[model samples]
Target: MADNRKRRPINRPKFHHTTFATTKLHEMVEFYEKVAGLEPVHYGDEAAWLTNDDANHRIALLALPGLKLPQDKGHTAGLHHTAFEYESFDQWIDNYLRLKADGIVPFLNLDHGMTMSMYYQDPEGNGVEIQVDTFGNWHASKEWMWYSAEFAKDPIGAHFDPDKIAEARERGLSFEEIHRRCREGEYKPEVIPEVYLPEFW
Candidate 1:
């Protein structure tokens, strides 16, 4: 008998960049720069292009007037928001302080057993994610399904400690360093301990 399970596709399109409308383009630029470290590599009077150290261009900031912001409950139309990855826990901490200084309170903070994240809404009410992946974060068993759920859910009211974050900084690691280590195959990921396991050893 032949196997009934569906086979994975040979290739899927990789994510490139996404554009979001904003009435506050200039303010948004400053937000992304100070918090996310996304540098604007290209721009026009009304539109700006931004890239992180990883991608050439990962986000586009578009100017829109007379636009309705998303409701307090959820996003109203178009792209909800884009999330960007950080290299280490320390990066998130520094960014967190900067966010507080700007009077932006995070909508959510969570530990999904894979990543630690801080969620915020942009000035225009778009979702913005700042996350650092735990080692061996991916669920090898159900890659696509698990991956989708990880980003889709809101992580509001989650608890995290600042001391752990300080430890990462003490080690002198940055997001750039993490990415570099990953690219060079120097970073070895460790499996996260299961939150729930059978009692019997």
Candidate 2:
């Protein structure tokens, strides 16, 4: 007799930061700086701490040898990846274009009804998602995610093209309009790549 969709954690814990173990420290640092806009807080050859805000460090990339990389085509369970959000659609588009110009692109881009997400592969084969809320605010987004029939139909969402999204934004298409068009399959990509599930070694 109760509304289950409205149920949520009473005290949601805030995400602090993420850390990664990698043998290629320098490459990881560069990738983080470009992708996450993070700068070094305490950097060294063996370990480095990076942050984009006052948190001191949002991500830590450490150097470790003799570590086996996650096997492709296997189900590995440890950490999938970390996601970072942008407040505005324009800002999100700019970041996408910047990454595209630098030859860094997301492997998967989806319209999840509530959010538009781009998933990229890090230097260590880790996934990094950059997303923007389609609804502008968390309150609206949460409501939509909870009750929208569109979400219930296909939660995996419609795959789209980043270039097409950027063009739509640049052409003065409203965020609402773009999202609607996306759902209607206007910007759908010809081919959507299959996400690789890792195998714990």
Candidate 3:
């Protein structure tokens, strides 16, 4: 018999996928297909599995007919949100603009010190976070998340205007420079967006 305690460092498992059960399965699937850049590898009425890259499926949608919304949301114990990370700032910005053109916009955008994040809501009102590691590498970003004073101060981070950030990118500002400006409160919008809380009906 192997002793699990023999392992010095706790082995962390890679997050392979997330499954969501929804009454509006089709709409939820469509939302993932559009917002997450995912495609249905094998889709059906009752269930659908989707992926953006090769590792089989990254998102699974299960249909539950005649489902009732909990009496109160944002208080239920379940998955709050799922996040997808883009490889580069340009890619993230481009995606944001593309979605904006498609009439989809993030409800909230924040610079989490470690990651510049954008939050969106699906058709089923599920929250989704799209992020880019501002430090441009996992190791540095992980370190910052662990020890950076900025992150320690306010973990939720400061809000940023997505439109202004897009404009800054168009005007040739580097990702690091833009991140600094955002952290220093250069692009706060006149009317800050409210954090998304699911409605009753």
Candidate 4:
């Protein structure tokens, strides 16, 4: 019998931005402007659209007058986070330093085999990620993530000290070398503990 299975299209669809409903419309807008470097492109009484580039808008904020969304409790279902990518390591580091100077600190920093990421939360407790790929091109990064032995060994990724990365940059290390050290360095791989696991048969 000939095998028959549906395969994904060779040209996959690209991703657009994410939208959030919030009570603190103004505050959220300000937070994105200061922290994410987004600019408001459209504004309405109950909605606003922001973007960092020439695209129509990368983030949409819709006002929810008196409603409050539940936080990420064990059983709650909602967005985990939305990530934005940087074009270069210099841009990523510069953004990190700028945010740090503004008193915004990331809750987590991880070095996935294919990328370096920093995660933060907005005032409304919405998660946001800023990242730069170890490989400059998306196609290359995706290929590495799919087939890299290091990623296969530790699928969850490893914790990286953001300060150490900054120090390395300050010492004039090349981006390629910095990324190499991160992938092979002392950082421990993150693993999910049994405590957080759900019971299954």
Candidate 5:
């Protein structure tokens, strides 16, 4: 007997928002507001909901009493990172410089073929990534991730020196030029070691 049942694909679900429980709720709110440019749409006594978009909240921070910052361990099971996408390279660079001016450093910068990303840690040590797509559209970026030979060689992405990138920008290098160099692997910035745990899945 042939049995057939319609099953939902594993990748069908869309990502919603991510919530974090932190004792430093106020500090967390400030970090997101200042660094990520998010606004607190809903501010309550125990929780704060923030959004950069029209959605009710893109990120939520709950007041947790006596919550100790989690230690970074290779085996720790928790939230890996939350990523925010930017509309343009200029916007991404502007935010990066703004954070840099505030003395907030990104722990990692990478050319991911499909996107350029800068990873930072919040005051509570939660990972956050700010990125802009390499391609003009989502469909093209998705296809690039799957079919790009560069990505096939290194799916985890290649490290780049954020300082060098900043220097290039300061020298009046165009975004298009920088982006092309990154894609073609000609922008040889000093590669830094990745700090995050490797993905097993």
Candidate 6:
């Protein structure tokens, strides 16, 4: 079994927040405020700062003079997607329902073994991920990041079975249990996994 005591420094200082440049800053601010429950703390004709908690600003909306409309082809060029974390499954569901109530259907909903997620595009087609971690249910037997890559490739229609995941949870499975089985190589490696396991020994 690989030693699990090793820790690595976080790259890029972790995610701070995401900023969106929009031609209509007020519209962007309104969308974020109503849909994501962000509180608009400061605003002007061309910019705004929205916060959800203690962070000075979690999402910034900047007005551009002539921002072009996003192409619908799904290629974001430099940015792949942005994800937000929720502490509870119930809160996650609440967010999901709020989006639905606003007649905004998610692009996709997925079970990534380590996380369950809903994918969506903002008013300007910026990809976003609203996700809840499974706490400790990540597959430990093999590289699961391949599965994550697969999910990213088809963010809206990757293979995810809710019943299968529910069964795993119902059985009281833990990451330690999964890791033990993975040490024995009991599970097939995902085509593209979502989580990375260290090779410490």
Candidate that scores best on TM-score: 3
Angstrom error at residue 34, model 2: 0.3
TM-score versus the correct structure, for each prediction:
0.61, 0.87, 0.90, 0.82, 0.84, 0.61
Kindly report which residue stretches of model 4 are placed more than 4 angstroms away from their true locations once superposed.
Answer: 1-13, 73-75, 187-201
lDDT of 1 by residue, 1-201 (tens): 989886875787787988888878988888788767779998778989898777777778888667775453251345545687776666666777767777865655545434666667666566687877655344542363356563356322234433344444568876445434433334322332222211221
Candidate 4 C-alpha error for residue 100, in Å: 0.5
Q: Note the residue pairs that clash in candidate 1.
A: 87-175
Could you give candidate 5's per-residue lDDT for residues 1-201 as a string of tens digits?
A: 876866778679776688989777888999999878789998887899999877888899999777665554324887768898899887888888888898987877888878888888786777789998878589999988888897898876767777667777888987767777766666555656565743322
What ranges in model 5 sit over 4 Å off? 1-5, 9-14, 66-69, 73-75, 170-172, 183-191, 197-201
| Cα lDDT computed for each candidate against the true fold | 0.61, 0.86, 0.87, 0.78, 0.79, 0.60
Error of 4 at 9 (Å): 6.7
Q: Please give me the total number of clashing residue pairs in predicted model 5.
A: 0
**lDDT at position 61, candidate 2:** 87
Work out candidate 1's RMSD over C-alphas. 11.2
Per-residue lDDT tens digits for candidate 2, residues 1-201, read 976785768899898889898977898899989997999999997999999999989999888778666565224566666888999988998999999999998888888988999988777878888999988899999999999997998998988998999989889999889989988889988887765532323
Please tell me which model should have the higher TM-score, number 5 or number 6: 5
Tens-digit lDDT track of model 3 for 1-201: 977575544787888998887888788888898998899999998999999999799999888787777555655676668999999999999999999999999888999898999988887777899999988889998998888886788998889999999999889999999999999989887778766545545
Output the lDDT of residue 88, model 6. Answer: 62
Worst 10 residues of 5 by lDDT: 192-201
Model 1: residues with Cα > 4 Å off, grouped in runs: 1-9, 65-79, 136-158, 161-201
Error (Å) of candidate 6 at residue 22 is 0.5
**Predicted structure 6, TM vs. truth:** 0.61
Candidate 2 TM-score over all chains jointly? 0.87
What does the lDDT read for residue 163 in candidate 3?
93
Judge candidate 1 against the unseen true structure and give its global Cα lDDT, from 0 to 1: 0.61
The candidate 1 region of ten consecutive residues with least summed lDDT is 192-201
